[model samples]
Target: MEGFLYQASIYLAAAVIAVPIAARLGLGSVLGYLMAGILIGPAFGLVGQETADLQHFAEFGVVMMLFLIGLELEPRALWDMRHRLLGLGGMQVALTTLVIMGGVMAMGHQWSVGLAIGLIFALSSTAIVLQTLSEKGLMQTKGGRSAFSVLLTQDIAVIPMLALLPLLAMPGGLSSRVNEATDHSDPGLINTAAAHGDTGMSLVDGLPGWGVTLVTLAAVGAIILTGIYLTRPVFRYIHVARLREMYTALALLIVCGISFVMYLVGLSPALGAFLAGVVLANSEFRHELESDIEPFKGLLLGLFFITVGAGINFGLLFGQPFLILGLALAVIVMKGAVLYVLGLVFQLRGRNLWLFTLSLAQAGEFGFVLISFSRQQNVVPGDMTEILLLIVAMSMMITPLLFILYDFLSRRIKDADEALEPDDVDEQARIIIVGIGRFGQIINRFVRSSGYETVVLDHNLAAIQRMRQFGVKGFFGDPTRPEMLHAAGLKDARVLVAALDDPDAAVRLVTFARRERPDLHIIARARDRTQVFRLYQAGANDIVREMFDSSLRAGRYVVENMGLTEFEASELQRTFYQHDRHSVRELAALWDPDMPTVENQEYIARARELEAELETMLLSQLEDSSDSDSDRKSA
Candidate 1:
């Protein structure tokens, strides 16, 4: 227990120290975790053999993560990705395997060895890729989604790869070491099951292929059925206990039980968990489940990444530095080439194409399982297995750098190719709207519907094209560019709307426009009170807080539900809005751009005073209305 506490302390301490620094430096948390692992395990020797075992346990994080991801995706959404999953994902595995295999064969290895190596390298790290994509907020992009489809396909392909591995086992190829280690553990996460010793359970053991298939099918069926029919009642039962901990326990029970079943049946536990999540995607309790599982998933995933760094066979790597480094780079380059072409073939362009290519270039965590399994199956030589392990770890370690590079390239890509010039504005309108995002779109429609000519300009080519489909004429260009603004007729425009999604960009545009055309009536969209002050300071005639109006409507709705008439509620809302707007203009004068709001005593005192005044005025109005109503009734 003492030893365990020490180990935990070391890991937690390392994370606390490293992660924030990495985040500050823009290196991402994953890389920080990896670096921490390397420090504690390899460089400092604070951790040792337990690293491999810990990694296996940490891999549960991946299962939990898949469950969460599945919760986000309905069956219909998963079905919609069928084409990319089959076409893009399937081809990537096949082509990458064949290419890597051929390369291995060229290096004087036998066909079986080459094929084993190929299968191992074909897969990318789903945990790392998905986590990184999510962190960077790129998971919803065309490239990120495509990458996810391929990762999902690779996971499914692991089953077939495992089945085919033993078939390639050479006659008398088993080394004594391998013979001693053959325990038929599940794929990935090292020899976790074997390390823990046999549980004496036999669901798929010694079964014929058909029998195993039936068992697999039945297990999957049970998960789906449980999700659809059983989870609700189970949750409701747990809810009766009125313990927040019970919900967490139940969520864990669902994941762990499904994982154990999958392990017993020789299937991917992560895949089973994912399947269960998809089944429950539309459940009323989905959000509750997500909230319960999210913390565990995050911690475990972080531990898993740390273990990966700790488990690196640095001795082997240093012994053959060039050979290992060369192999790792080769895998990344070969896979990158395949993904790039696939991206092009599938119509991925600009930043997205580069994103898709760079993100999946590294060998994944699953490679560890395949490499170890191959050794037990005698498909890969012992010496080659160590090299492959090093290569996989090194590649996984390099993934974050690839993501950083993608960030760099994405900035340069700017949504369109450099060769694609901006659309020329042949005509000008009285009203010019910059950035045709949600905010500007409504204004454009309203102005146009009222028989007013308006010019729309946006940086997103896709958004512009989509708007054009709705018969809204929007030119594709960076609205912040001085030349673009001039072409859009900012000089003669009566009203200039800076409704950009980016607060900084909107402020900059407003500042530039105001300076260029002082007479131009510039209305700017602000994300928050801070932005409102910034935009007001930038000389925007009217600064619209994005959520203020919606929030007021919601507040009015609440008041209406609380026994107030709609008219009275609306009057209250109107009074609040007017007071709020006037207070904003007053506070903008006191807002110090150089100082934090909490530190500004004048601003705080004035804000408090305004709040008190508004409350008193609202109470006075309500009292007057009540008195008038009473008088009329008495009359």
Candidate 2:
């Protein structure tokens, strides 16, 4: 109990201090977690010997994370994602593997060893890419969606490669001598004292080479099939346990169980755990399992990155500077080439193509896992693995910067390779409204009553279908597109009014119409000051903030109805209306959490006081007017 408390304290402290600081610095949370691990782990040696052992055990966080990731991805969704899985993702892995393998060969290593190392480096960090995109609020954008599809495919790709690794034997292989270590063979696993003892070994001690391979395959199959058949029932029983903490315990238990099976079969634990997660994706306990496992997964994934960082030997890089540089360049260039071509083939265009390709150019987190696994398999030496791991880590560290680079490149080149221009817009209608919501419908009714022809364009089909049921003449499609505009007859239309609820979409339509039909008068409803700016930018002839203008007209009538002197009523109403407009603009600018605030307390207080005084002034005028009218009547 004392040891557990001591070790937990150390990690807990590291997480609390490091993660927030990293987020504040704009370095991102993953970097912060890794920095914490490095500080407490081998680099600083602050955790001591006892803590090192605990930290190693805590590495289960990553295994659990992968399992949860698998659970979120249903097999059907995965199958639906195959075009990208094979086209974009498969291309990246194959091209990177081949290119890096060639570079390794040029550095005097044989293809057998080079091939193994290259394959390991083909992956990119799924966790980081997904989390970062989400954080940046770009996850639903065209570029963000493309990145997600490619990442999902890569995650699924890792499973097949793990199975394929042992099949890739060394050249002129099969030296049949027991108790003999081959120099040509890379350094195999540093078998621990616990493993060497008679505790676990049974048939592995005397099995032939082929028998050993078969044993591994059989063990793997048994676990996968067992996990498939038993996970749902096991989770159901655990649910009846009715304790949330125990459900978490059960989740961890299941991951460890699957991981152990994979390890015993000489397979990747991450892959097995991931498969277990996939099987449980649709289960009733899925959300509970995810919520329970999320913290550990996050911490462990962070520590795993740090472990990768600590494991990078600077000595190897200094000795083989050129080789390290070559390998890094090869991985990026190869992966990048495949991604670029994929963007074209997959119909990803302009900025989206650039974003998709560049976001995934770096080597992934799984590369570290696989390289560590490959080292144990004797397919690659420790030096080679260490060098490759460092390269992968550096690539990860530069991911944010690379994304920025891709953005810059895309902006500069986007105009040249843009999506095809929309066809000509319609111009024949007597009255055209870009949107058909309540506001637009009112104007549409008024115009139609005047015997003017009215045409409505709305993007939402469901809304249009309902409108059609009411005998409304409305076309359903994106009103922003030129073709849709042309089809709606914008060129001959006497007037165009844009009243879309989404400000951005409305602004887009405003801009498109301005360019196509400069002579037609354009009136747009602005949602707020931002929309006001957008309408102005789009060359709107008249921009109306629906609330602002409505409130102003209402304020004028309210002041007059309250029996105020005419001039006083007009002045008070104007001041208050203008103040309200200014307030909205100021509020919009200050909405961000980090946005700057009013610096002087006195000025802020005075501003509030003045606002109150204006309200009193408006009300006092009404009271004076009321008393004078009574006095005049009595006299």
Candidate 3:
């Protein structure tokens, strides 16, 4: 117990120390965890050499992550992403495998060995890619979505890959020795269970091949049915318990129970968790389950990455530094080139293409499983397996650096693109609209109809093209670019509207415009209260939340529906709007983006008090008006 505590302390301390520093240095938390693992594992030897054990445990993080992802994607949403999942993802796996297999065969490897290696190399690190994309706020972007689809396909493909491995095994090639080697080396859950003499517990243990397959299918069906019918009621009962800790325990229990069931049936536990999540996607408890499991997922995921880092055979790397380094680079280049070409064929242009290519160029954690399995099956030689493992590890290590490079290159390209365009401020307009998307379009129409000259700009090429088809002209350039702003004649513009769909970009544009043209009146669109606060900080003269006006209009209709006259509803709405606007400014003043949770709670409480006070005052005024009218009629 003491030794266990010591080990835990070391791992926790390393994460606590390393992650913040990495984040502060602009490196992502995933990279931070990996670096921490490297530092503690091989660099200083703060942790013991039992990385495999830690890895086996930490892989639950990946399972949990997949569950969260499944929860976010409803059946309809999954169906919507089918084209990209099938076309982009399917092509990527097929082409990448073919390319790698061809290369391996040319190097005098057996066909079976080459095929195994190709399939293994085809998959990219889902954990790393998704975590990085989420951290950088790119998961909603075109490239990010494409990458996600591909990752999902690869994960699904693992089932078939597992089934295919036995067929590729060479017959009569020291099968006993292979089994012995596998017992010592295979890190997979099934193999680990077998190593621990838990075969009797496996659902497929005594079954024939067909029976085993049937049972596996049955297990999956059971999970789906339970998710659809039984999960909600179970969670609803747990909710009535009113113990958050119990709810959390129940969430973990569901995930673990499903995982164990999948393990028994010889399937990927992560895949099982994902299916279960899909089942509960529309349930009221989905968000609660996600919130409950998120911390565990994050911590475990960090531990998983750290283990990946620590498990790297640095001794082997140092012994054949150039060979290993060359192999790693070759894999990245080959995968990236294939992805880039695929992106182009799929109509991904400019930044999105590069993002898709760079993000998915690394070998995945599953490569470890495949390599170990291949060695055990005699499909790949022991020496070759070791090399492949090292290469995969190196590739994983390089992924974060690749993201950094992408960011740097993207910024430079954006700047160069802006610089290349000559700033010809020929057509000057009084109102300069930074974004001509849905929000800006309405604003532009209002200004144009009011007889004000307006110039519209948008960064999306496709959007600009579509707008031109509708006879609405919009310049294609990033509004955050100072050069683009100047090209739009910011100097002589009387008013500037920051109406970009991206809140961060909108904030950036507002900050730049406010600094450059202090005399110019700025109208900024915010998506939420957080953005409202940010826009206010950016010197937006008028900040309009995108949904606020529409909600108010809805409220007015509700008042009319509740037996109030249209005029009375309108008047009440006007009063409420004024009060709400005042409240927003006051709240914004109290809101520090980095404020403590306790202080934030206090602020929220104060705001509620103010709202109640305003409601009472409004009712009092209305009563006074009614009483005055009654008195006048009597006179």
lDDT score for candidate 3 against the true structure: 0.85
RMSD of 3: 6.0
Give the winner by lDDT: 1 or 3: 1
What tens-digit string does per-residue lDDT give for candidate 1 at 404-442? 999888877764453478899877988999888888889
TM-scores for all candidates: the values are 0.94, 0.61, 0.79
- Please provide, for model 3 over 1-635, each residue's C-alpha lDDT reduced to its tens digit, 9 standing for 90 to 100: 99899889989999999999999999889889999989998898877556777787787888899999899889888899899988999999999998888888998988888889999999999889999998999999999999999999998888788779778987666576356454634422123342222345788887999999899999999999999999878888877889889989999998999988987887888888888998899998899999999999999999999888777778888999999999899889989999999999999977788899999999998887777777667777766877898899899999999999999988987776655553344566878998887898889889888888888888776677788898877777666888778877898889999989999999899899989999999999999988998999989999998999999999989978987778777878888888888888888788878986367986788789889978987787677767877899999
Q: How does each model score on lDDT? A: 0.88, 0.68, 0.85
Those runs of model 2 whose alpha carbons end farther than 4 Å from true positions after fitting are 1-14, 37-59, 133-242, 314-327, 373-378, 381-383, 407-424, 428-431, 435-635
Q: Write the per-residue lDDT of candidate 2 for residues 1-635, one digit (tens) a residue.
A: 98778767777788789879988977677667667766776466655434323334445665676677677788786677677667766776777778778877888998878788778766777766766675667666777777876666666576667557656655332343111221222222112211211225343446787987888778767666765677678777777878778887887787777777665654556667776777777777788778888878876766655554444444566778787767676677777887788788888877777778887888876675566555545566555565776688667766766766765786677554333343244435866887778788788888888888877887765567687798876776677778777777877877899999888888888888889888889999987765675577678887778787678777778867876557766777776776665654444443432433366454456557657866786677667867887999999
Judged by lDDT relative to the true structure, which candidate is superior, 1 or 2? Answer: 1
Cα-based RMSD of candidate 2: 10.7
User: After superposing candidate 3, which stretches have Cα over 4 Å from the reference?
Assistant: 171-175, 182-200, 205-210, 416-434, 446-462, 469-471, 475-635
The clash count for each model shown is: 0, 15, 0
lDDT of 2: 0.68
Instruction: Give candidate 1's whole-model lDDT.
Output: 0.88
